[model samples]
Target: MLKKLVLIGGGHSHALVLRLFGNKPLSGVRLALITPDIYTPYSGMLPGHIAGFYSYSQCDIDLQSLSNFAHAQLCLDHVIGLDLKNRKVLCANQPTVDFDILSINISSTPTKLSVPGAVEYTIAAKPVAQFLEHWYQLQENAVRNPQKALNIAIVGGGDVELALSILAGVRKLEIYLFQSSKELMPSHHQSVRRIMRDILSNQDVKLHLGERVCEVVKLINKGLTIKCESGLMVTCDQVFWVTHASAGSWLKAAGIGTDDQGFILVNDNLQSVTHPHIFAAGDIAKMINYQLPKAGVFAVHKGNPLYENLRSMILGESLKPYKPQTAYFSLIVTGDGRVLANRAILPLPSHQLWWCWKDCIDRNFMAQSPHQ
Candidate 1:
């Protein structure tokens, strides 16, 4: 009897899994992929793309080609829910896909848009495809009305701030960053934070520290007013929410074991806690034994182990545990022709050479696809 293996979301881990499966096909196992888009953008090159250093085709993987190479049926649809009891995957537009084994590698979106008018006013810097639409429009507006000064307000103190700052510089727009915390990038080392602060400062971007947004009010003139808890209000033409990552609500609704934030709870082998037949990786998964940041590099690294375990499960073989490295090297593009290199709590100097290194690494990863 043949078993169906369904992979959801064309994320980095799933992309790698598809490539690996294509190279080493398994007999009697049919594969299918469910995703919303035919092109999956590489997070590493996103800033470069925004800065006009890379084109859209250069930064995104051709999922259609990759799926064809893997000999898997590509179902382009947005997943709405899962029929866990029936071992079926539900979609927004397509019919339910049945699978003996399933894996989810979907990305997360900002869910803290609880404030009034926030959802209607702010653009979440996730579901990258959607954001790119607004981004392109913003660029056009900037070019069309160069004299009118475009003001952009981004909420979040994470690595996103750095990339947005680069965009602000490239577009020559007035940018403001609002962070609830007093300091930026709490996960990074003091040195890295200091460097980021210095870089953002050099970019002439305004910073609003320790100011928690209370409400987002749309103005009659189609502008936005960001009111903070501290009674501070700032008016801007656009607001970008780049805050915390939240999993899809369908995970919780499907009765899957998830973290408090609704991210799937997975073991060392990347198998779902409640259902061994189901596996999860990438930002949507929360490792129960290890707390990992929702970073794409980690998801990319999980590809190998996840593929092995999935193949082993299909073959009725033993599964292997995947222990993430205690530390991984991080390269942050400085928006200019420079990059910042760091590892865990250690920070290195920023230089243009680092940018070259990062560009090479990102290109190599993209080149792994069947046809670039």
Candidate 2:
């Protein structure tokens, strides 16, 4: 009997797996990919795309062609739940998909809050697809009404500096960033954080640190009002939520073994601790022994190991363990052809040379697709 292998999301890891499988096929193994978007945008270049440095087509991974090359059915639907006991996959549009092996690479989302108009007014900026859609529409609105006072609010800390710097180029609008903590990018080097803070202030980007938004009220014919728990109110044209990262809500309800944050718990082999038949990678998974920060580079590197382990598991062979590196270089686009990078305690100041290096890396990584 042929074995069924279903990949839940077209994330970086799964995309790499598809490319590898396209080159080498495991006998009697049927593969399929389930994702909501036909083109999964690469996070490495997403900030550039939003900043207007890169075009939409440049940063997006062509999932359709990749699936075709891998000889996998690309199911254009959202995975709503899983029938774990029956070893079946549940989706929003398609019928139940039964699989011998399942690998989930779905990325995490911001923990949805129950603010006044948050559900209706705020946009969660993870999972990439929805944020892209939301930005496009908002950009159009801003372009059409040049005379309208435009105020954009982003609620999140750390690395969001990259986003705010680039988003300043998106339009001639007042951009505000709010972090609940007193300090931004707390994990980063103090010098690097100070440099970013200076850059934002110099760019006229309003900074509201230590103010956590508790509610959002959509003003009729005006804009949206954001109320912070710190007794502050600000109205903006759009509110983007990039709060704490949390995985799919359905994972817990479906009885999947996940961490406190709702990410699937997997062993070093990337197999679920409780259910060996299920595997997870990327931001959607957490390693039981050593946890990896939610980074695209880690996901990119996990591709080969995940493919090897999957092949090993299906063939009744010993599964090789995948040990993620303790540290990796970080390339952050500053939205103006300059980049800031750091690896471990070493930090590189903002410079165009770093930007060139980052652009080269991103382009090279994106250029590998057989068809993109």
Candidate 3:
């Protein structure tokens, strides 16, 4: 009997897996990819895209054509839940998909709806499609009214500096960045944080550190109001929620092993702790032994190991355990063609040469897909 392999979400890891499987096929195994979008954006180039450096087609991967190349059934639907006992994958718009083995690569999203009026008034950064739609519309509005003053608020301390710089390019724009913690990027070294802080200050972007947002209100004058737990209020033309990472509640509800934050708990082999037949990768998974940053670089690095282990299991071979690197190089764009290079083990200085290096890396990764 032929076994079925189902891949959920065309994230960076899954995209590489599909490309590899296309080159080497396993006999008596059926493969299928269920994703919400036909073209998935590469997260690495997202900031550049927002900065107007890359076009939509330049940063997006053509998943439809990639799936066709891999000879996998492409089911474009939103997954709602999973039927683990019966080995069925439940979706929002299609019938239950049966699978002998399943791999989940769906990335995470910000904690939306946690604050009042957030869902209605603020924009969540994940589901890149939705955010892009609003961003493109805002750009159009800015173009139409070149002299209008805009107040933009970003409610997160993530690497949104590039996004802030892009907003600052607008004439008569006031940009505010709100962070709950006293410092930004608590994970990085103090020197790195200082560099970012100085850049934002020089750009005239207001910093609201240590302020936890409690509510977002829609004003009657076609604007928005943000209220912080510290009793501070600010009005802005638009609010973008780039808050902490959060996974789907359905994972915990369905009895899958998940961390406190709802990310799937997996072993070193990237197999679910509770379900060995199921694997997870990318931002949606948390390793039991090593805590990995939910970044695109780690996700991309796990691709080869995940592919090898998945192929090993399918061939009745022993699975290989892999450990993620403790230290990695991080290049962050400054939204004006400059980049900041940081190595957790040894922090590097910020320079424009790093931006050229990052562009080459991103373009090479995107060039892997022949259809892209």
Candidate 4:
């Protein structure tokens, strides 16, 4: 009998695994993919999409097509919960699935930081589908109501916050970036930080640093008012929350050995610490040896190792460890064909040609059909 391999979430890592495993058949292994959407958006190109640099069709990976090529069954349903003890995966609409091996690659969600109205008023940036939909609606509204001043507040300090800055260029909106940390892009070098700050300044984007949001209140006539710990209040039409990315709630309920933040804990082999039959990759998997950033590049890089490990586990062979790179290139577009490149140093000046280079890279990445 063929071993059943069920993959939950069509995230970058799992998508690569699907493609690799499908292309070179994993001996006697059957594949199944469960995800909420058929198309998975590439995060690296999202800023470009928001900046009008790329179309939606250019950034999305058609999971259906990939699955068809992989000969994998695609289940378009949300995995609400899991019964780890029973070795069954629970879903919102479809029947539970039994598997000989399992892998999780679901992306994270924004942290519900207990700030009073954030849950009700602020929009999370992690759920790509919902955020993309909201972005389109915001753009439509902006075009329809050109006279109204669009005051938007981005609550976070990370690469996503930088991406949001690029998005501001396309909109006639007054943007404010709120960061509880003293420095933006805390993980990046000072030079890169200065460059980003200069970019935001040039764009007329306000930065509220070292201030924590105490409460978020929705006003009746006005929009949303965010009260900070410093006794300052900011009123905005829309709030974008891009904070710490938390793992899927289903993983926690499923008794996975996850961190307090809900990210699944995995060994170097990408096997779950708690469940030997299970594996994890992408943002959902936390490396025990090294702390890797939850970037798409890391996930994409994990594809080969995960594929090998899965095959090894099935073939009763020893698993291999996955080592992450210490540094990788970071290219950020400024919406108007200008870009900032950072790897070892701060943001280096990148002009339209750099943007074109970045565009080519992203397009090439998206063009690689996992199915083929």
**Top-lDDT candidate index:** 1
Tens digits of per-residue lDDT, candidate 2, 1-372, equal 798999999999999999999989778899999998899999888888888888988998999999998899999999999888898989897799999999999889887565567778889888688877888897788789877767888888666644565465566788888898899777777877887888787778788999888888888876889899989998888888888789878998889788898989999999999899999999999999995778888999999999998888788899999988888787766777788888877778779999888899889988888683
Residue 133 in candidate 4 has what lDDT? 84
Q: Compared with the true structure, what per-residue lDDT tens digits does model 4 show for residues 172-244?
A: 7788788899898898889988887887777788889898888989889869898999998999988888888
Which pairs in model 1 have colliding backbones? none
For candidate 3, report its TM-score: 0.97
- In model 2, the Cα lDDT at residue 198 comes to 82
Model 3: colliding residue pairs: none
The CA lDDT of each predicted structure is 0.88, 0.85, 0.87, 0.83
Best by TM-score: 1
lDDT of 2 at 59: 92
Give candidate 1 misplaced runs (Cα > 4 Å).
160-170
Ranking by TM-score: 1, 3, 2, 4
What clash pairs does model 4 have?
Answer: none
Judged by TM-score relative to the true structure, which candidate is superior, 3 or 4?
3
lDDT of 1 by residue, 283-364 (tens): 9999999988888899999999999999999999999999999888988777787788999777888889998999999999
Which is the better candidate, 1 or 4, if ranked by TM-score?
A: 1
The digit string of per-residue lDDT tens for model 3 on 55-155 reads: 88999989998898889999999889999999999999889999999999997988967798998899888877888888888888888998888889998
Model 3: per-residue Cα lDDT at residue 107: 71
List the lowest-lDDT window of 10 residues for candidate 4. Answer: 160-169
In angstroms, how far off is 188's CA in candidate 4? 0.6
Q: Model 4 misses residue 68 by how many Å?
A: 0.4
